[model samples]
Target: MFSIFSLIFGLLSVVIGILATIFWIWMLIDCLKNEPSVGNDKIIWALVIVFLSYLGAILYYLVRRPERIKQTGQ
Candidate 1:
């Protein structure tokens, strides 16, 4: 009985950890590839995301990226 419970929780933890890792990697890549037209804040936030981990990624996308920077007129 205990073995079955452990297996289920362990599997769930692994899956969640993997998903978080993937999202972290994706955010790092997004930061690097963001255009100069997007401005310096983008790079700053990207560095923040890479250095700070998951919270940085969430903050970058949720608050900074869409709301802070304007699209280039050109």
Candidate 2:
């Protein structure tokens, strides 16, 4: 029988896994949609996200995401 703590940990692990998978997918799509001027090669970014998984996604978000320009209506 699983202990209470063990069950909680297991549940937490599953949740984390699901969240990570979602994050990875979102990052992959974002990378693909990013313009060339926004970063380096889109293919390379996608590969990195695939191979490194969650960590790669975090890295791309932190390091490679482009800055947004504010539109001033004249």
Candidate 3:
């Protein structure tokens, strides 16, 4: 029998996992669509996102993404 707290935590974990998967997919697609400009390397960034998963995606968003945006002026 599962306790209420345990059930809640389990549900939370599942939700978090789903959200993470979605974010990873979104990042992967974005990396694929955008060209490598300046500091960004498209293939390397895609691999990083694939291997590092959530952490890679976050890093790309925080670091490489802004650089690409700046380069494009959009």
Write the candidate numbers in order of decreasing lDDT: 3, 2, 1
Tens digit of lDDT per residue, candidate 2, span 1-74? 56998999999999999998998888888777753543566778788888998899998878766431112110
- For candidate 3, the lDDT comes to 0.86
Winner by lDDT between candidate 3 and candidate 2: 3
Best model per TM-score: 3
Name model 1 segments beyond 4 Å from true: 35-39, 68-74
lDDT of 3 by residue, 1-74 (tens): 56988999999999999999999999888888884644548888999999999999998888878888898753
- In candidate 2, position 20 carries an lDDT of 88
lDDT of each: 0.75, 0.75, 0.86
- Which candidate's lDDT is highest? 3
TM-score rank, highest first? 3, 1, 2
Q: Looking at model 2, report the run of 10 residues with the lowest lDDT sum.
A: 65-74
Question: What is the C-alpha local distance difference test score of candidate 1?
Answer: 0.75
Residue 66 accuracy (lDDT) in model 1: 66
lDDT of 2 at 1: 56
